[model samples]
Target: MATVNLDLTPIHQCSADGCTFNASASCHAPAITVGDHGANHCATFLGIPTKHSPTNDGHVGACQLSDCSHNADLTCTASTIEVGTSAGGGTECLTYSAA
Candidate 1:
């Protein structure tokens, strides 16, 4: 038998408690995407009450912001990331920084 290892970046902390994937100040979506038309918003953030996750450990599966320093090949290379409400009044990747 063979084993595979995935080095996806984990979400450190998420303040979007209203999201279905959020629990205990963490994200449990398994994987999240960071990018909303070049912005640092979290595209995976959903406020609906369906499909809730049981775990609190989520990872960054993909990031569409190529201008971010932590993004590489559409993937987030940061060791961990934080998500929270943005100044524009939307869920965003708080760890985002211009390259």
Candidate 2:
């Protein structure tokens, strides 16, 4: 399958409003990954967002959110998304949406 680099420069907020990593300007995490639906959780599987590009169909690997309700498919299904710093020290998403 062909790979397409996802532009993480668009996100500017974290879905988890209580997260400390979320700043008023941008995400505090060093890196982030696009969720199957939107952006809702840090990509810590490897402690960082994978370098793989998104597919044309918009499906990626398993999501990294440990507390997500739809974590079964490793995908997100929220209306909006949130950004924040990973558990370590990088930019990440705290919420996502399929819409």
Clashing pairs in 1: none
Model 2 C-alpha lDDT per residue in residues 1-81, reported as the tens digit of each score = 445334323343444334343444334434445543444435432333333332232222345554666454544444335
- Give the Cα lDDT of each candidate: 0.86, 0.43
Worst 10 residues of 2 by lDDT: 51-60
Candidate 2 stretches with Cα past 4 Å from truth are 1-41, 44-62, 86-90, 96-99
Q: For each candidate, give its TM-score against the true structure.
A: 0.88, 0.32
- Native-to-model Cα distance after best TM-score fit, residue 43 in candidate 2, in Å: 3.7
Error of 1 at 55 (Å): 2.5
Indicate the TM-score of model 1: 0.88
| Candidate 2 local Cα displacement, residue 18, angstroms | 20
RMSD of each: 3.2, 9.6
